[model samples]
Target: MVGVGYTLMCEQTGPKELVEQAVRAEQAGFDYLVISDHYYPWLDAQGHSPYAWSVLGAVAHATSRIKLMTYITCPIRRYHPAVVAQKAATIGVLSDGRFTLSLGAGENLNEHVVGAWPHVHQRHEMLEEALQIIRPLLDGDNLSYSGNHFEVPEAYLWDRPETPVPIAVAASGPHSVALVTEYADALVCDNPDAAVVRMYDEAGGTGKPRYGQAAICYGPDEDACRKTVHDQWRWAALNWTVKAELPGPESFVSASDHIRPEDIAQLVPCGPDLEAHVSAFQKYVDAGFTDVAFVQVGVEGQPMFLDWAQDELLPRLREL
Candidate 1:
């Protein structure tokens, strides 16, 4: 069976509320929870960006059964790979082997705050170097390493779980898919694009768990859900290239100023129709994603969505 997951979007929800939701998600029958690690919200209207690591720590204690993971963290900038290893190890220990570390090349939106963002090629190279240091350290290996993009002098994790944390890499294109096949134990994507899975499998990710994220707006009124998605998640309708380079929420708002609610309605699964939600999830499962995470776009209706999902959507998705 494909595992169903929930996205804990730190960019929209406060830390305390996120933890409370994590507990609720566990009770709602989610197999796992993936939290976004962001220093800033993608849009100002989203209104929140708490430190994800601190929130994950609280979640570790608050929920006992649900799996925990970083949807994607960029260790190339704003953080050293060694520090990421420490954080991953600590969370793994806290969650008792239920933590996963998902990584990416990162975006200028968050990393630019630390310094000038590198070119796309350079960032990928940096991520490669970062992973070289991170993977070993997560396994409790002492590493003294020097690479073109990173340097570490005898660093290791002392609090690692008995099982090393699984490392998943996010990839939206051929180059990144190649990286995932080469290094990651799992693959993650924001879209249910079949090309990604096909490339991963042809390149040797056949049996690995593939995670895909889908956006949904669950509410009683279809039009209201569409409006909410437009108000909050229209940033998603922008091309990935645009999203990677924009430096702040204001930039996102300005970039998406021309977007309309109908555009979001076409992209995200909207409203109370159980089939709409189930069919949306089916796209990911059909594309061979072993794990699918639903990103409920708006702030409200989490409880209603969860209850509805447990009662209706999940069973239908399992049938698919």
Candidate 2:
């Protein structure tokens, strides 16, 4: 489907602007809206962080027809699955049954809030454990759950929507993909390349919904687009994905380990043409993403951004 998601770039966007953008996104023909879940924005990176749940509440009222979701909420870190279940249930009702909970264990940067649990694969393990608790609870329970990572006593959501909520898992590996295939209603991937799509299908996922995401930087001058992208996205350069070409976070870190400030110049594109930007998304569709979201690269071309994407790409993609 034609969906839109934002990464919560703390640098230039905030909750208020996010709602405004969401309103426009829906009016502009977007069917679903997803936002990233991060406790704090990277200080050396994008430099802006707002509470995601509060922002989602605002979005629920700001747009009437748009579906809201966490691109991937980290239920294994700070918040327990029960808490997430409650919050997600509230949002689902508030949105008139239009909320989906996209779950993930968490990441090193967000979960590594020193003084807290310090581990890499803990979130994944916690995720599997949490799901076992969550599915039962969502099916209607007021009982306590005692898992290794999280424990609760008689916690329950008295106010839940009538329809059963769908959980979309953000899976990147074989085990996690299999977990999503077996348990989750949908699966999400950031890259949505051919190989990434293959992972889900190979894991035994049939016609389940799978979504993909990518960012685009289109402007008048190619040099300007690349420069702006590098300025704000230098942090992404630090990400491990650039060099190793592997899907893990370590590869992102490895790429960042060797990436110079100028390296992103070649990696990110600067196609001022709307057709080119739309073509970028076609790769995702060809690779088999049932849903695709685009993070607009820079703020300079906001109007041009919507004008191009909505008119040229959205109509054709709205059918997906």
Candidate 3:
């Protein structure tokens, strides 16, 4: 089934408001709630970056049917593996096993607070180590293993789900996809290019579920949607310029607005029409993405975006 989702940015909205929004998304016909995790917002925006796990806890009680997830959280840097394991377990239990852990090596915006970004090779190595630590903890198995990057003492989690909440690694490039295919049960990516999405399927993944995501404004009018794009999603779009290469350990230096569009344009669909949105997402479907999560960010006119998404966009997906 094709499932619709929303991004919970820790911003102007509070826990109560977010729950309302989550419920609203459900009421609007979306099937999942994706709460984004960010330690800090873009410097200029000064928006609230709420602790996503806490919000998900509230959302758990608030929404009974919709699946919940982290749009993509960096397991290696922003939080420790133990913390990730515990939180994932808590959310899984809270949502009655409707939680999926979407992860990545991390980006400069979030990981820099911990230290210099690990080199690309090291980042993958770090993620692999993180998975090693997280899996057992989530399974309620005692763990005590030491790795080149991280170490965990004799620790175990008692409060875990009855079944493993499928873990999805958010990957873009071929290398990361291959790495995650070895460990992760699923793959989640914001990039919508058919070829890009196919890379994941072509890699080690055969029958695993895949999630494709994109930024959308969703309003009835074009101008309103554009405003949302500039306000929210642009934080990632502005400085996506990859003059050097895909970010890695040494390469992921601190950067903002400097991010170039060429890098992310293929990932974030532009335009105000519903057809464009469908076309962009269809690429992912054509590439074998069975699950698609659309973040209703970018472009204001809140009611317009949500209403159409439910009444129009969603119904069309039914046909697809």
Candidate 4:
């Protein structure tokens, strides 16, 4: 069966609600759960950004059957690669090996807090350097490394899980995809772009799992769903270059000022239509993603959305 998952958007929800949602998602039959690791919400209206690692720890104790992972965490800045490795190892122990450490080249919005944000190319290089440190340390090696962007004098994970935690890297362009092929155990992407997957496979990621996220606003009222998405996630319509370069939520809000509520439907499926929701998810399945995480956009209707997913959506997606 294709693995179906839910995302706990740490950028938008408080820690308590995030843990509750994890439990609810598991009960609703999701195979896994992913949480975003963000220092800021994309827009002020979204209104909640908490430390994801702490929330994941609570989630580990709250849910037993569901697998857990960061949708994508950046080890390149605000966190050293060694520290990221230690955090992943602890989460792996807490979740009993259910955690997958998904990382990215990072967005300025999150990494800028450290007072230095590199260009895209430099960021990729830093990510490769980070993986060099992270992978071996997670595998129980004591690491002392030096690279253009970082240095690890001597670091080791003392409480790693029985198995090495799987590492995934998010990629959208050719350069990032190359990094994924070289250093990642799995591939992660925000969109259902087959070309990205094909590139990863042809570039030596042939057998690795491809992971992607699908965002939707599921509510009884279609117009309400659309409005909720525009209010909370319209920043998503901005291209990757813009999304990665913006430094904060204020910047995103201004950049997304031109977006209208209806425009969101083109990017994210909104409303209660089961076929519309299923079709949006099928794009990921068709794109060769082995695991898909469903993001219920906005904070208001999550419980309702989970019930809808369990009662209607999951079965329909399984047929795909």
Question: CA lDDT, every prediction?
Answer: 0.91, 0.70, 0.71, 0.91
In model 1, the runs with Cα more than 4 Å from the true position are: none
- In lDDT terms, how accurate is model 2? 0.70
Cα distance off (Å), candidate 4, residue 79 = 0.4
Cα displacement (Å) at residue 229, model 4: 0.7
- Give per-residue lDDT, candidate 1, residue 64: 93
How well is each residue in 1-320 modelled by candidate 4, as lDDT tens digits? 67999999987789999999999999999999999999999999999999999999999999998999898899998899999999999999999999999999789999999887998878878889999999999999988998998988988788989999999999887888888877779999988999999999889998789999999999999998999999999999999889999999999999999999988778888888899988878898889999999999989899999999899988887887
Kindly report which residue stretches of model 4 are placed more than 4 angstroms away from their true locations once superposed: none
Tens digits of lDDT, candidate 1, 62-133:
999999999889999999999999999999999998999999988888889889999988999999898899
Per-model root-mean-square deviation over C-alphas: 1.0, 3.9, 4.0, 1.0
Pairs of colliding residues, candidate 2: 10-48, 239-252, 240-251, 240-252, 240-253, 241-252
**Candidate 2: RMSD to truth:** 3.9
State candidate 2's TM-score.
Answer: 0.86
* Clash number by candidate, in order: 0, 6, 18, 0
